[model samples]
Target: MQAMTYHGPKRVRVENKPEPRIEHPNDVILRVTRAAICGSDIHLYEGLIPDTRVGHTFGHEFTGVVEELGPSVQTLKRGDRVVVPFNISCGTCYFCKRGLTANCENTNPNADLACGVYGYSHTTGGYDGGQAEYVRVPFADVGPMKIPDDMDDEDVLFLSDILPTAYQGAEMGEIVDGDTVVVYGAGPVGILTARCAWLMGAGRVIMVDHVDYRLAFARRYAQVETINYRQVDDIVLHIKKMTDGRGADVCIDAVGCDASGSHMHTVLGKILKLEGGAPTAIEWCINTARKGGKISLIGVYGPPWNMIPIGTAMNKGLTLRMNQCNVKRYMPHLLEHIRAGRIDAKGIISHRLSIEEIPYGYEIFTKKQDECIKCVIVPPRAA
Candidate 1:
């Protein structure tokens, strides 16, 4: 089997590796068909996430066909086509029972925070991801959803992570009818977040990003207003003016740790390693939201020590909600939306490369080159 292995920061290559097998009674072995390089994967590639070991595989959004099933797995069979949620949950834990699978206590019990997530760093549980010809899936009955026979792999691949993540971000905004919403970042998640806001009855949706191509992509695909933050002297003031000085009713931070707005944050966080990751986007969200407005953070943040404007949030009576998305909770609902043609989830894919070309795929995506918005990796079996 050929798998994408991480060597170090900005170093990855597809090389022959041993195929995974069923380790637990509930495990299943998947012959990967489609996998994606997430924006969050860049954090691991850049060494922003802690405990990301060399030789680790780094992908979580994937769909595949079950090649083998463990003894206890009764919900699926060897030939079932499935899209596995990134979060590995037991489905019977306190958090899982409450539909908060991202914090499942039974998975990654060694960690105090996030539950086990495929292909994330060791902090989230050192489970290898699906950026390979074959991969192992645990707690199979609870995580992998059988794909509809009428749909293609591309149509459901993102339900593993980004699509549900974007939907959860919009849900956290508490957007009401005729509410004005502003989304920071125009990446895949941001674009989808903007689209989801409209479905939630937001009267207006604005997406922000310094990258012109992504902003343009969002405007065309997500059908929302876009702001190129690089052109403005003060993004906070500009957003305030756009909202008639009341500020946006809801603001979302889809750009997380690697945000590149403030010099101090970049220098200290990315360069000096003094802070977790840059809090530039979160700051913008806090500063630009209206008093008593809701702010949703769907962005990936590493350590808890990043500097935040807590005083300002408290003073303005803002509502802040954030978490690693409970992807299982929204998969069925979003799948229905996709089936109804309300959301063309596959339209966001800008690049599709073979598994062997993953390194180059990473280069173009991280550099924001070739107008790349999303990149999917097709293993040989599916290609």
Candidate 2:
């Protein structure tokens, strides 16, 4: 099998590797059909995530065909097309029972935070991801959802992560009718978050990013106001002025560690490694939100620390919420939205490449080249 093998930071290539086999009673082997490179994957590719070992594949948003099933998996069988959640969760756990599958205790019990996630890093349980021709899925009964026969793989591939994550990001904002929501970052997740905010009855949505293409795409796709943060002298002040000086009712940070705004944050966090990934977007969210406003963080940040504006948040009595999205909890509801044509989830895909183009996919996405918003990898075998 050919897999995206990691050598080091900014180094990945397609190479022949042993195909995964069922290793647990609840495990199944999937011939990966569609694997999307997430923005967070760039963190791993750039060697930001701790213990992202060389030779490990990095992908989580994928859909595959169940080529083989483990003995204990009774609900699914061979040839079942499924989209597996990135979180490797055990449904019987306390957290899973509460619909918090991302924190499933039974999986990744050794970790202090999130449960086993596919190909994130050793900190997230060291499970290899699906950026290859095939992947092994464990706790099969709990994670993999069967795709509707009428739908194509492209139609629901994001159900594995970003779609539900975007929806969850907006839900955390606790938006009410006529509330003004400002989303920082106009990437795939940010744009999707803006769309979800409107669906939840937000009267207005504003998406911020330096990339003109992405901001324009957000305006067209999510129908939200767009701001090129780079053009403004002060993003916080500009947003404050936009919201009539009171600040937005809700602010969302969708651009995690890679956020490129504050020089102080970038130098301390990304360069000096003093804090965790740069909290530029989080800082903006805290500084620009109205008093008693809600802020939702759906961005991926690394461990250790982030220099956040805690004093400002406390002073303003802002409500903050954040978590890796519990993908299982929202997949069914989102699927309905997709089916009804209320949300064109697949429209976010801007690039599709074969397994051989894995490295290229990562390159264009990281460089934000070719007007790319999202890239999906199709393994040659599946192609």
Candidate 3:
């Protein structure tokens, strides 16, 4: 099988690799139908996550059909179309019981270190990922959700990651009826963040980004107002004015480490120029947040922190919620929403290509070309 393997920094390749088999009795193998490249994949490509080993496959956002099942996997059989949750969790764990599947203790063999994840690294449980011809799904019964036959792949692929992540951010922000919410970053997750905020009854949703194309897309597709930080010198002041001087009631940071004051200061230096001054989305959130408001962070982050405004948060009495999404808990509800036509998440997809064209797809997606919002990799079906 040809799989996208992480060889090293700035180097991922489509190479022949061994096909995965069910190693655990509870595992099931899926013939991948569609897999999307996530922003997190860029972090790995840039060597942000240490778990990415040479030859490890590189994706977590995917949907597929069950090709085979382990002896104990009775809930699903071959031919079941399913969306695999990005996180692998054991339903019996304490964290899982509390709906925190991202921190499941039992499935994370390296729990003393970090939560285990598919196609991440040995530190993240050493499980193989789905950016390949097929994948072995650990905790199959708990992780994979059967999708309705009538639904398209792009509509529900997000249940695996971005959409749920965006929803989680909105939920954590405690967005309520008539509240004004501001989301930082106009990436795929940010666009979905605005959509979810509106779905939760937010009166006005403001999406912040330096990229004119993305901000425009947020305005058009997500049904939210957009602020191009580069074009506006005083984002905080402008947001306040837009909200009648009360500021945003809820602020969600979807840009993660890419924003100013983030650990990846060097990267921010590169992209911030497009948005003018420092790319301080986090700072903007603090400056523009209402007192007692909630600030939710769903962007992927790495080690060695820097330049966060603790005093601003303290003075404003802000509540901070940060972490990865517990995709398991929200998968069922989000899938229903997709099937019911409540959300048209597939609109975020800007490109779809065969697995063989992954290199080209990565080039365009990495450069974020032609208003590229998201890219899906569809491996050719087995002959």
Q: Whole-model Cα lDDT per candidate?
A: 0.93, 0.91, 0.81
TM-score per candidate, in order? 0.99, 0.98, 0.92
**TM-score rank order:** 1, 2, 3
Better lDDT candidate (1, 2): 1
What tens digits encode model 3's per-residue C-alpha lDDT throughout 323-349?
778998898888777777777889888
**lDDT tens string, model 2, 98-184?**
999998887885657899999788788888899999999999999999999999999999999999999999999999999999999
RMSD of each: 0.9, 1.0, 3.5
**Backbone steric clashes in candidate 2, count:** 0
Q: Kindly list the per-residue Cα lDDT of model 1 for residues 235-272, writing each as its tens digit.
A: 99999999999899999999988788478888878877
Clash totals in order? 0, 0, 3
Off by over 4 Å in 3: 112-114, 260-264, 267-279
What is the Cα-based lDDT of residue 114 in candidate 1?
91
Ranked by TM-score, the better of candidates 1 and 3 is 1
